[model samples]
Target: MAIVKLSTTERRRLSVFFTCLGLAIVAWIFTTLSSPLPFIINEALVYKNSPQKKAFHPLQADTIKITIQGTGWQMLFSKMKPDSKPITVDLTPLESRNYVVLSSQLKLINAKRDANQQITAIDPDTLYFDFTNRLTKKVPVRALLGIDYQKQFAISGNVSIKPAYVTVSGPADRLQKIDEWKTDSIKASNVNESIATRINLQPVTEGNLTIYPKSVQVNIPVDEFTEKTLDIPVKLINNHNYDNVKVFPQKVKVTFTTSLSRYKDMSDDLFEATADLDLWRDHGYSTLPVQLTRFPPFCKIVKVSPANIDFIIKK
Candidate 1:
């Protein structure tokens, strides 16, 4: 094929023509997007004024389709961001009726929204709810803790929660199923000192349920621990025959760790060590094993001298 060549002036004119065409296309797009028009978008709904005497569950999804009138640019952006803040819907009307008309709330809803993008209409126009018997109950709050104490440090007393129980109000059936509410996990390492802080309760996922005072104050008493030794007399148990039986060792030294604050309060009276004669009689064992029948709950037993004891039985 023969090649066709153009002069320098002709080439320049061609380039200018295409550039103008591109500019016109760009201007057309901007003008179209700047026009005001109606567009549809979905928005989440937030409820207020929930009835105290009745528990309600929405009959439909918690979202509504809204027709908004705004410039094309606003519509485009709204479409891109479907997760904008939810529109607050008043549920006061539910107290007298089972449904609420969205049209009536348009004025209030629009008052808080930007003027550039106004909501024109709501799909489904009305909201409906299912009602159930409301029940209020108090449930204990349980704390979840993950703590690592430093050397010779430990919890000195019971962990205290300011409000031991939380008030929950919801559908009777739902509330009945809930026995207790728990706080979020409290985690720490090298926890040498007492802890005092506010912790949030696990949120109620069911929209119809409500919990009062979403958070509670926690107090954990921590203290340094030291070793304590006590000579506790070993008592004989299950000596049914009342035979004269004497254990070689009458007392054993018990070494345990207790909180420094309670060190002075520790004594042999708080512990009970016993030798079970039943062990020797039932199994014909040569020696009786000594065991601690009772001890302080907070103390950690470290060493018990002479775990097994020799006994003499006079026939």
Candidate 2:
């Protein structure tokens, strides 16, 4: 094809038209992508892969105000949120604080965001971590448990926790006074059956503290109790005038309850029933209260038949 050259005025007019067309395209793009939209993501910052020798503290809790831009449809339907996991911020880049800029970690933060969304600005643009030497300590674990059984039910044995101690590693000063860590509240109500469950260790507010065993298994022994009766002789003591007074009944029935495991261990020999003569009256016959001086361990005294014994005064 042969080229036909136009005059300078015609060419100028054509160049102007092309320039206007180019400006129109650029204006369309600027309107579509340049206007910043504010999207505030709250409580979404996470730290990972920090230096093993150094510990970081007071992780930033401020909201991430990401001023982003996208096509109208992209901004309308697709939510633009940032995840900080992929962001690798070297806190000890130069073994000094000056290396990382104080004003903005956005470049480090931007690496974590979705690629399609364009970020124009971020608010509170600076975050600096306070670093300290990592610390490790072995602390004991205490359980926090409460139980209320149904009527006539009780615990058979002590509550037991597996792995009574845990390793807590964090900043030295923070872990220095923490001799023990307690588990979260494990409350069971109206519980007649035995309890066996895994309990989580209560976390401390200290930053960068790691627990070796985050949880432990707790076992509680429970069983329905049984009661038994035994005739125990009442021993009289501390009587000023024993020859002048007499107790009518020589023995009383003592009823007690114990766990099945300890049922066979209880006997009248393990208990001592007694009556005091201090409250005696000069009347022919009077009632005196019977008191237990001793009883078997872990056995509950339910009843003492004939709580009051009749005594006839001879003098």
Q: Pick the candidate with the highest TM-score.
A: 1
Q: Model 2: which ten-residue window has the lowest total lDDT?
A: 81-90
Pairs of colliding residues, candidate 1 = none
Q: Candidate 1 regions off by >4 Å?
A: 1-46, 58-89, 99-128
Please provide, for model 1 over 1-315, each residue's C-alpha lDDT reduced to its tens digit, 9 standing for 90 to 100.
Answer: 998798999999999999999999999999999998898888888888889899988898888899888888887786676548688889999989999998999999999988976899999789899999988899999999999999989998899997999999998888879999999999999999999999999987666899988999999999999998999999999999997998979999999999999999998999999998888889998888889999997789999998888999998
Most accurate candidate by lDDT: 1
| Model 1, TM vs. native | 0.69
Q: Which clashing pairs does model 2 show? A: none
Write down the TM-score for model 2: 0.52
Tell me the tens digit of each residue's lDDT in model 2 across 198-293.
Answer: 999996544356777989988888877899899999987667665565776889999988877778877789999998776663443368889999
Model 2 backbone overlap count: 0
The C-alpha local distance difference test score for the whole of candidate 2 amounts to 0.71
Per-model C-alpha RMSD: 5.4, 14.1
